[model samples]
Target chain A: MANEPDIQSDSLLTVEQAIANLQGADLGLRVYAAWWLGRFRVDAPEAISVLIAALEDEDDRTEVGGYPLRRNAARALGKLSDRRAVSALVQALGCSDFYVREAAAQSLEQLGDRSCIPVLIRLLNDQVPGTLPAPEPPQLAQPFDAILEALGGLGAVDAIPLIVPFLDHFIPRVQYAAARAMYQLTPSPQANHYGDRLVKALANDDLQLRRAVLADLGAIGYLPAAETIAQTLAENSLKLIALKGLLETQLQHTTPPNLSQGAIKVMTLMDELL
Target chain B: MTDSLVSLIRAVEDADSSNRLLEAVENLAAARLEGAIPTLISALSYNNPGAAVAAVDGLIHLGETAVPFLLEQLDAHNYTARAWAIRALAGIGDPRGLVTLLGVATADFALSVRRAAARGLGMMKWHWFPDNLLEIAQAEALEALLFVAQQDEEWVVRYSAVTGLESLGLAIVQAHPDWRSQIQSQFEQIALNDDSWAVRARVWMAQQRLQTESIVQPRLEEQPSPLSETDWQMIIEKLYDRKGQERLVFAEGDPRRYRELVVAIAQNPKPV
Candidate 1:
């Protein structure tokens, strides 16, 4: 029985069963189990321990499609958001597989641990400095965006200089990510004071640029920009996002001042139009 | 800062071995080094599929920077070089390449080149550009894709054209509303009548996707667990036994190997 594969309803396995399956010989079972444990997120020490342990399981020697078990484990650990998995996730950053490294970085972001800052910064720096402007391919894993977003989530102030250059990157995704990360790292209401590249980007003719900047301003809760964003509602190209930013600003604002009131008016108007 | 990349560019030029040339192209593209565009364009002509794929990826990575260089290669004396250049440009999806792709998709001598062009026509990534031109370009692109889908000789080319047809409509059908009929007619025609099984199958999937678009709320982000608190607790106890080392074996015919179970595990039930 010990050697007989524990093949529970592959998706419905109990956390204990899934953890045990993580140690199983069949590669697919291990991958499935790791994913299940993460989905369960039972908040058990044993579940996290097994996921971290699975990170070192390179035993699946099949070359086709690469070994996905470890990658799945890393992703599961991220979903679990256990601080205990931080060191393991950080180590997985250097894994040879792009998916594994991506999974590790994304998990670190989800974990929201500031301790992962140095590693995230290092990974961001390692990316090819400049690439042409393009949307991130739907299926491609974007390590640069993952790293920058992690740094921003962690609020690494020192990473601002590193994140700044990417603001002008030709890749629209990278440019948008750089703006968002900078917004996260900079103190709110003071984003414009810190060179506010997103604000600077608002001057560009690119509608995507305006939309991304508006989203970031709203996300960062930069209340001062609410009025400016509201002004764009007259332009059909920018109206929907302009309204979204105003709504976000209104909701996230702690202060009930003219800015908040104006946001309310704009949001109500947008709602009525809708 | 680009010193190492400069050395790689020289290596690509001077390398005696094909393997070295390919490696140099990979390094240049990975690093996204300056002056790697011409080298990547030249490497596309190589017989090696690995190197050719890498070159295409490299040129695409270079984005608009490689557009002019790629366009220039259409006039190259070598036909193989011209074909590869079309593929690279197609992969890049620049609006500048649209006319060239249309021309090649219809008249290119090589069937491979025409197929590549057809595939490129489908992959225009129109949203990447400024919005003012989107409506015009989308209309033009759809017309061209339909032309290829209806008239292309090779089943492979038509298959690719069908994909383009689907892509051109998927996004705007909901918002424009008027596009719904045209998209339905095109996709339904191919889904029911396309001769090749592969083409018919792809068209069928596209048709289904279009039919369901309005009913299904497109999922933008991962959601929480849909399993009830009781169900979650039940699954938890059964799976969370830390002391147990042996794995649970699902019977061979277990019904849990389906998407519904995953949805139950992964998605949160909405509040009534």
Candidate 2:
């Protein structure tokens, strides 16, 4: 009797117990079992399939369910980094329920597959942002910001093309995510080469490009480009970016007065232009 | 003994801004007050839809406190409030509140709130919402048909502010004042400069107005849209508006991960 722990463990077929608990008439108990199994990823493949089936359960209409089982599914998939789950997660995007859709979007992001970029990009066009339905009473207090982090973490190189376009979003948050994805996809030479092209682009035919390039050069903080930038600041329509860049670059360097040639040249140009 | 009841009817018939008067009704829902209830119910007689809404909203808030008193208003002179009383019972949302909200939602007036009450009736998920009405295809709202919800009339409504479909009507009526003068003259600006195409189109169709500019051409703004590829670079700079450790998380985002761009730059600080 004292050493009967093994018998106790044997008496309870744990996976069956978890699945049975997951099916309790009590919604909260069922959700808890699903959540624990999903998070621990210890569920039998049959149990994983059970949790997945529960994703479509009407927890939405139930007042007592701890979470819609779909979140548990997504979290489980993310924990497992199970590549097989990607298609199912992507399919969840169309769930009439908004929160479920958000979870699906987030799970796909967590998977961080190069294939998911097109899907993530496709979501950017979802101008009507929230898909999460209004939960029945005791509305969720803290809204989820999980998808942003998940997308940022995916760090898939293929996301570069898809994510780059959204960087110009009217809302800064969207652009911030795109910027984050950028560093993950293309870090070193892209930055250096991209910076070089930008400096060269200051001479582009398009005035807007030229103006933008001046600002880009400023952001690069490259000392060699400062003299050329100073020359362009003189009587260039792109003067403001040049002037700002020159000032910012000077500050970045903390140059001694003797090395003030770049700042001095830009100032003389500004006086002439003004 | 005082002025005949008919004259009391005449004065309340001319009141305005039904939406606010309706708001006034909400405050009275739990209050034991009686004066505002009758005034609001009396406004129901007015041709003004706003005044009628005030009456319904007022009665729903009055709950049991004003119910018996209001029963007389519905029973008299084929009064509109009687019909509205049943519908308002539905909007109150609570089952106990049902007798009142339903009184308003189904009330047979041509007013907008009455329709909202009916739809509200169908949406109630509890034992309260009847399954029978669920099959009743939602009657198209007069608010939608007349585009009253979209009316830019007065500063009270505008094209940009509306979140739902009703704004389409507001935009239409805004540009076309003959439809509803409640909107301002700047309806033209809404058509010409507003961000939403649906709003602009509604206003244009309502006024039967057109601008030569196609959707492809953005109307001129005080500032230009970002056009150059490097404009994206400007956007990135703005993201890190402040420098140093404050932007460390921003700098470390995937773009700057193991090959931390900000760190690399800081270590080899350029002598610009």
Candidate 3:
């Protein structure tokens, strides 16, 4: 139905330009290019290598102590799905910027590298000493939510005891993250308990927290949450995305392509949302 | 004005360091003196964000008393001042600022200005209008909010517009019961079609609020001393104000208290 030349030219031209910009002198362009490559899931070797190199970028620092380039590069590398990026991203875990470390941890989870487990585990106990009394209550120095999610996604069964304590973490988002990881590490009947914690989070007044819970539910494909997710006070599109994840998981487990009851329920909910 | 108040006003204009300027503005704002209104409005035009923020807070604290000066002194050339002024007016929620909010919500070049205006439009003190003119004023606000919701390029502005529409919709449905279906249908269409997930999510929340309001309306009407639409508006405003306070405290203190408050708020029935 569409012209082949136009499609090829459009995508290729954009990819090449993004690659060029990632290596360019402009800091903003480089940051944008890194995000573009990751957003489009560009998996070309050149793109991956350039993005890897970007992880070490020192040029794009913010005045308030942030490394925008490194953050974007680390995020892009994860989406690129290149094993070569695993080492660089692991090293980025030590970056001074809190957000860069957060982004690196999330990317490592996506890359699914088991070797990064020890480093991530150490991060669970990492606490940065505050200069002042900490105007707010003391939070984990390390990004616990990202680290917990990463550990869970990487299938670190030995880290289960470590993850359990965070189920009662002070922050609701962190608590939800712990619940998400707990379910992922142990997907038995007890997974429903973790699923219930996530369900309760849907009632949180914070929209951002609710959005994160939706993503976590979708990521783990917890079918028990499908109906509750549908009725939650979140965006219908997010509800649909979460339901799609549940349906996909159901289809994967079914021997035949025919919809299982769980899949049918997810589809029906998705239909109502649409 | 006292000499210290005059000094604080002068200090706001002459302070070299950002910290000093912020302190001066905060002191003046905390004073809550009528004479300091002009200086607070002028501070909105300053390059220091901390000073501007303090000034906006001060103006909001002055309430409707500051509205006339804010309306007359709104800077045409300074976008920063205009944006902060819009925030002040939005926070005040005086009915007199409705026209300005409507103007900027639809046409402001700055997305932040437009976003503030859009949200502010819904929060207007509709009770200030006489019974004869209230519907007309509300209709104008609804028209502007609908335009912004459907046409704004920024997702954040459109998100604010949806928020405006929801608040205004609650007010409208109570005043004219026949309009409930139309408002609900409009929200449904937006929920089904909006490009931003956040916007759609907000619309989804708005739909739930509308449905709850519809169910509660008859019970409210049956009361010995029936709650008027203005009473419902005041309650909504108080809840929103409480939520805003919770957010501010949540950022700087133990979140356990904030979480407890959120739970309490959620458990309580919010009459639309």
Candidate 4:
């Protein structure tokens, strides 16, 4: 008789070990477990419940008043593809730590929950009093980039008017997020105009901003930008990833045997990069 | 070497603690002794990142004097030491390191090394080269920079290439007036099509600077005689060589008009 290993048994062991570490006293191990569960896409109910509980973790605070555990947990929850963690992620949007809030917004986007749209939009207009401007590029207190990106991914078209002003945001990265969200919310024909703003942002001297804009272009499947993305001065790896995003987007939106000229161009570019 | 320099060198080589090595390197670097160059360069091969950084700073402080030693001591087997050596060579901006800088900027496995080398290429001390050799050197530098700008896989390196191009362009325009049109055209193309917005933005800033800065004007009066038909034909041929046939084909019907158009464009290239 041929012996086949039990894949289910191995996964169960991993899930149980991750759950134990998540509930363990060691803060570092808990953080690792949270990341492991989400990274590996563990969808166990125990994993979800513990990750949700971790969002409220009070013990794992950074010297600068940031919540490392809460941040990692929130990030993992989104990757698990579980809707059960959505409410906890939404609540995490109110965390004092900007990164925690950013992480929460990103995960919430991954969960594809529409209920978080109102909360995210409110953050667009959120005016935190007494908060000092960011050291570089001088942005507002809220994680506007993440919020806007999440809103766009959720297809919240109603948030368009509110997001428009952020195109003029002082921080270029935030402006890029606004442009990306605008492109996502606007329908085709009108959408390329917003995509152009991102294309223009690709000229910014900040590598991070260029990378972000490339990602935004890819996520929106902005095929008009394929040539530009391919030629962009970013690392080939990042350029390839962005092009793949565009290709995936094209595949999903087009029918078989009728790839648009833009799609064909994107594939050609990807071929060259590969 | 003085007694104090010897002791500092000993401290750098024999110190077990990272902090001690860093302090020794710092003191040695601050000493600015010519003899300390070898010791500082040796410190680069040490495992401690902090000491290596201090050693690089010290070598930079040594400036032109350290260039020859830096070039000779570049470790082919040790990437960390080689990277630090590149940084030192880049920081000094010595003409002697130009070949090394060009080689690494184009082919270094480490992105940071390539980045430093790319930036260094633009800032070489042109005055150090003899007038006869300056033109040739600048041309080589420009070609390397153009290749890096268009071809480097990393945006930051490409970005550095733009900076190098601008600085070198400024130097070339001052020294070799005939090269301005080519430099201007190169910048225009980079600004229009470079994928990284940062690289594009840098090109824009460079164009603005080139326009606003009145570094040098063409010395038309210095020519002993006016351009004859043969000279004009040669100029047209050179233009064709640089821009290809398609770009120059527009003014084929009228050579005078073509010459005028070329002059106008070269005198006032369109802003990116």
The numbered model that scores best in lDDT is 3
Per-residue lDDT, model 4, residue B221, is: 43
Mind giving the per-residue lDDT tens digits that candidate 2 earns over B1-272? 23433333334443255444444433443343555566655555543433444555566665544544554565666344444544444433333332233334333333333434433433332322122211111112222222322443311112212222222223233233443333233445565665433344334433432222112232244232212323223322332342222345534333423333533332432332
Estimate, for each residue in A25-49, the C-alpha lDDT of model 4 and write its tens digit. 9998898888878767889888899
Classify candidate 2 by CAPRI docking class: incorrect
Q: Chain A vs. true chain A, TM-score per candidate?
A: 0.66, 0.50, 0.89, 0.89
TM-score (chain B) for candidate 3 is: 0.75
Worst 10 residues of 1 chain A by lDDT: A127-136
**Candidate 2 deviant stretches above 4 angstroms:** A1-15, A62-67, A112-115, A127-162, A165-175, A189-274, B1-272
lDDT of 3 at A193: 90
Question: How well is each residue in B1-272 modelled by candidate 3, as lDDT tens digits?
Answer: 89988998898889887678878999999999989999999888776655777888899889878987888766566767878788889888887677778778988766777877888988887654544345546766877888898888776678778778877877777677655665677777777787765466557667766767754333333223133445434433443454464364433653323544543443342553
Q: Which residue ranges in model 4 land beyond 4 Å of their true spot?
A: A1-13, A127-139, A256-258, B1-272
Task: Tell me the TM-score that candidate 1 gets on chain A alone.
Answer: 0.66
Q: Assess each prediction's global lDDT (C-alpha) against the native.
A: 0.64, 0.44, 0.76, 0.74
**CAPRI band of model 1?**
incorrect
Query: What is the TM-score of candidate 2?
Result: 0.29
* Candidate 1 local lDDT, A105-195, one digit each (tens): 8799889888888877777777433222223355343467667767876778998999989887767667767777877777656666632
Name the lDDT value of residue B120 in candidate 3. 90
